[model samples]
Target: MSKSNTNTRTQTRASLFTPFIAIILPVIIASAVLYRLDPLEPVHFPLDKINRSAITVPLLNKNMRLGSEKAAEGQVLGPEDLVYDAALGVVYTGCEDGWIKRITVNESVVEDWVNTGGRPLGLAFDGNGDLIVADAYKVTGFHIYV
Candidate 1:
């Protein structure tokens, strides 16, 4: 609380960041130089030749909506951003219905995963396969940890 103690605390916090900068600064500088030095030719595809296949999922052409009605059984509504779990073959999405829905891509099954009690706007899966949601009107972003 006093001036000397506050100064020491500030210095301690500044020193804590020093080691991180020291370790990362050289790597960053070296990466910038190496990135500029690397030999790589620019690629330019013809305007007419580029198709959805050029930069999309392998099965992006599949009509996922045709059978979604039967799969969802009228559960999913206003689905927002989704995260696909390749290992689980499922996609988690936030919905305007105030629930997070899990759709089993392989089986075409829809299940209400969680009730956020508010309009869920975005969805993501953490490293441990847990779902994260962004509830609307919360004044927050996708970084909501829990």
Candidate 2:
């Protein structure tokens, strides 16, 4: 190839990369900013340490297991807390996707009950059978009808 043609091709390739760099740079910066912001801050709670010696209980026939397999439904991202309703037999879990999930306790089936439009932390059932959620972004309580 001629020197002029090679130089032109090099310049074109460099120019093509410029736009990609421009697009990717902002994405990287925004990701850093979002990481700093950490919208799920309220939901992230550290667990209290367990003191084994202080506890006294009768030994059971069943062995204590560490963890259980999550249901076949896609995993719940950033699950903060969970509350169970005895009457309805449903377990509500706060998730990072700005949604609260209702799962059947026996079957481990999950469904998106409601979207809070914000990250939910704690959940409780009121006397009226509505689920009250503590949201991270909003001060008002989120109510979910059963």
Candidate 3:
């Protein structure tokens, strides 16, 4: 109410707000300048293009439900890639636990085939019955198992 008291209050307010403005104004100005300049020049990859194809894919049946059966008992963890060997009557897959596993198509038999000591991602069989496995992280390359 008094002039001296009002002036003192106004000065205190100004003093308290000045430091915030000093810090905030520089940030606002730098943001504006960086937005204008865009020094980093961000690159966005066409992830959708890389991930999906142009062809129309069939919609999955909504009524489909997963069967209640454990394929391999604890030995196979995180199977990534699969290959079928018609001659051997088996389906082979590479697992994250650094082991190649084979399970029969009928889900009757499961076997541990190979251990790369690294994560295995993909598995394939050549004409000569050589199994090629793509191992990652520690091994970093392909290994052929005969």
Best by TM-score: 2
**Tens digits of lDDT, candidate 1, 1-146:** 79999999999999989998999999999999999999999988887775545555775766767755445546678888878888888877788877778899878788887777788887777776666677886666444333
Q: Candidate 3 residues 1-146, lDDT tens each?
A: 89999999999999989999999999999999989998676799888868976697569965566664666666668889988888878888888878788798775588887788888887888778888777776545665755
- Provide C-alpha RMSD values for all models, in order: 17.7, 20.3, 12.8
Query: Model 3: how far is 45 from its true place, Å?
Result: 33
Error of 1 at 33 (Å): 42
lDDT scores of the candidates, listed in order: 0.78, 0.84, 0.80
**Runs of candidate 2 exceeding 4 Å displacement:** 1-74
Which ranges of candidate 3 are over 4 A from the true structure?
A: 1-70, 73-75, 138-140
- Tell me how far the alpha carbon of residue 3 in candidate 3 is from the true structure, in angstroms, after superposition: 72
Tell me which of candidates 1 and 3 scores higher on TM-score: 3
Q: Provide the global lDDT of candidate 2 against the true structure.
A: 0.84
lDDT of 2 by residue, 39-71 (tens): 674664455544345667877735565465555
How many clashes show up in model 3?
0
**Candidate 1: where is the Cα deviation over 4 Å?**
1-74, 139-146
